[model samples]
Target: MMAMENLKQFLVLLSGAAVFGIVSIVFVLTWVLHFREGLAWDGGAAEFNWHPVLIVSGFIFLQGTAIIIYRLPWTWKCSKLVMKLIHAGLNLLAFVFAIVAMVAVFDFHNGANIPNMYSLHSWLGLTVVVLYGLQLVLGIGMYLIPVTPASWRAAFMPVHVYSGLLLFTSVIAVALMGITEKLIFALQNPKYKDSPPEAAFVNVLGLFLAVFGALILWIATRTSWKRPSDQILHTLHTNGGSEDNTKVSPAMSQLSGGMDAEEAGEVRRRNNKFDDNTN
Candidate 1:
């Protein structure tokens, strides 16, 4: 009953996140295609339109989904390695989109003779992107590389998780600042002060972004929703092991309290085999 209730809550939050994410993308697209000059690569305002569209769709939405991918119950049965690859793939795609968006902005600025990376929004956005790239590289190196020491992976896991979430939140905040900055610069006739339709529409987009981020964060942080370790699953299946005996190794818990059952089982099997050989 409790599990069912949790599942229901998770589904509701996931659905809400999906709705907000889609709406945010639509809002950004409408803002660019309808209110602005639409997309182009001509080093003009049209090219700049791609920046917001890609950022909202690829950077913000994709990254947020990737962050919570491991928490999905349906994928819990998959090997950790497989899930890691998927997670990395999503982040890589998001990074590519972010790079393109940055290029669009830079090209637009250069063409217009406008200064670049001057505002708080630009500075923070650039910083977050760089940090996100660094985070991705480090995560791949530490987690994906089999040669990497288990102890090192365990020690770095908390930092990796925290940094990912921090980057996710920071990007959304940067995006909100970015849209507002654009509105301030773009709106002239009615002005942003008069609360034009575009201004109101974009404001709602910002609200959607905020709500989406909140839902993703909530889903990611829930301990009960975390994947169960192989040890726990094995104990439940066998109906033999004591609660204390089924507890995961300190290293495994540190690595990921919710690490995939298959991966954990494989590691334990290997360890048991080594013990037998040593004996």
Candidate 2:
């Protein structure tokens, strides 16, 4: 009953996050296509429009989804290796979107004879992107590489989790700053203080981004929603253990102590294979 209740709550939060993420993408698109010149690659303001659009869709939305992929109940049946690959793929795609968005901004600035990276938004935004890339590389090395030690992976799990969430939150904050900066520079006649329709619209977009980020953070931080250890699952399957009996078998527990779920899963698989070969 408790498991069912937790599943329900997880579903609710996941659905809410997905709604906010989709709405954020739609809001950004509406703002760009309706309020501003539509997208283009002519090194104009139109090209610059891609920056916010891609950032909202890929950086914030896709990246957030990737962050919480492990918490999805349906995906639990899949191997952690598969989940990691999907997670890395989503992030890689988001990174590609970010790179393209950066190019669009630089091209637009060069064409307009405007100084680049002068604003606080640009500085923080670039910093976040660079950090995100580094995080991705390190995560792949630590978690995906078979040569990596279980102890190292276990020790790095907390850092990896923390940095991912921090980067995610920072991206959203930097996005809000970028939106405000854009409004200030673009809204000369009516000014942003007057709250023109575009300003109002983009503000709502920022709100959606913030809400989406919050939902993601909430989901990621919930210990109850974490993927069950593969060792536990293996034990339950072999022993026909009840769902409530989460305690691993003695051998599995001994092998998995002090390791994170992924590392423990690796060790469990190796031990099982060794036993099978010996038999």
Candidate 3:
């Protein structure tokens, strides 16, 4: 049991490190690549690179996927199932709108000026943000309240896998779109003379993939281990089980009791007396 527990703990930590490592890498890249002095919406000249935005969008989806995956059931529960499904669906919806927005923003602004595409993209993203907020509310309510999480419920296995599927699909879709939009803009921009679209794209895409890969590794490596509370659970379960068995044993034994000859004779005499009284 100790070995099993240690192995489980090792796997869990490895998985968690992979996820955190990816997030840290991506966050650092976002800071490095997109943190140019002129990134404001105002007339200020700023550095504009769409790759970081794309990667960030995917990172959020990845985060949501991780949440949904962890919450997904190892056992059956109607309540858990519904919440997981809704969480998955909402995140996916948010992902779709967010991707559209990422592309639109890239098209609308290439760091020179805020374009119409940027406004549209911003609006679209805002709408999805609303959706994500709703999801957050629903997800929380499921934990606290006693409703079917919302009107839909399902089994835990599908809830876990489907939520992840939705998250991955939505994020990757937006990320790819954002990347394309940025690349196209770079190709068309006149101010950026030294950097090749190919090189910039490769750098952005490479970092994004690397970060995302680490997170995936973590998710795949997940293993179960008993926490410090396991001892408490073991004791409670044992005592409760023993108490129940003690109570039930005598009742069961009496129900299975057989009468000896003398007892049977006594019972017959009592029955005759009762019959005589009735007559």
Candidate 4:
């Protein structure tokens, strides 16, 4: 059983690595080979080029990594608090990249006298970015802020998780749409439009994005993949040099062993909060 579990974990890790590799290849093929015009603020199409490159690297790829960070073997040795910080930080970076990418598009538009938000891709991209920013803020407030009430945290947890997955999916969808729109709009040549190498490469890139998202969601949604309570405790001890102050929540307690009356009450409260959220 132990060996089987280890093998499962290894396969999971391999899947994640493969996703990352595909993402990197797609990035290079899109930004480096197809469009060699590096980023520029005032260079019209060159400035606009940053949008896809940054969006894919930061929004899609890095964001996927942030979502699956918990499954990474390196995180097992780190304190949960540290992992939380890393998670938040990575997301913030992704958000920054997305914001800059959007900015690049706007800047290019103004410089080139082109209209903005004129396509389905533009509208969906804007909406995803806005919701993603809100998700990040609420996540930080709920999880990292020590003063947040346990009731609030419990109530918000489900929404947070749901919205995160939703937004991640939305980002990938928007990216695929954006690339398609770009291909249709920019590829004016008959040869390029009719099954050209660039078009084929980008279409494959879109498939990569979809596959990466699938692998990430698979790892994230697996119940057995959650951090073991014992591992969490061990990490806390290693980081703090003592375990006297760390308080495992009811959820963790339930995972570890039998729940005492107090823990049972806590679980009831959590359930009530969840019920309220459902309503």
Model-by-model lDDT, in order?
A: 0.83, 0.82, 0.41, 0.70
Q: Against the true structure, candidate 4 has what lDDT?
A: 0.70
Best by lDDT: 1
**Alpha-carbon lDDT of model 2:** 0.82
**What is the model-wide C-alpha lDDT for candidate 3?**
0.41
Return the candidate ranking by lDDT, descending: 1, 2, 4, 3
Model 4, TM vs. native: 0.79
Model 2: pairs clashing at backbone N, Cα or C within 3 Å: none
Over 1-279, each residue of candidate 3 has an lDDT whose tens digit, in order, gives 124454465456545645654654455355435533323333332323333443354445344444434322231123333444554455555455455434544554554456553543344444545555554454444433445422232222234334444544444444445444444444544323446645464456545544554555444333332121222223324445343222211111000012223334544554464446448
Best by TM-score: 2
lDDT winner between candidates 1 and 4: 1
Ranking of all predicted structures according to TM-score, beginning with the best and ending with the worst? 2, 1, 4, 3
The 10 consecutive residues of candidate 2 with the worst lDDT sum are: 248-257
Candidate 3 regions with alpha-carbon error over 4 angstroms: 1-134, 147-161, 187-207, 210-279
Residue ranges of candidate 4 with Cα displaced over 4 Å: 1-3, 6-36, 191-193, 230-232, 235-279
Q: For each candidate, give its TM-score against the true structure.
A: 0.86, 0.88, 0.44, 0.79
TM-score of 2: 0.88
Better model by TM-score: candidate 2 vs candidate 4? 2
Candidate 2, which segments miss by more than 4 Å at Cα?
A: 241-243, 246-279
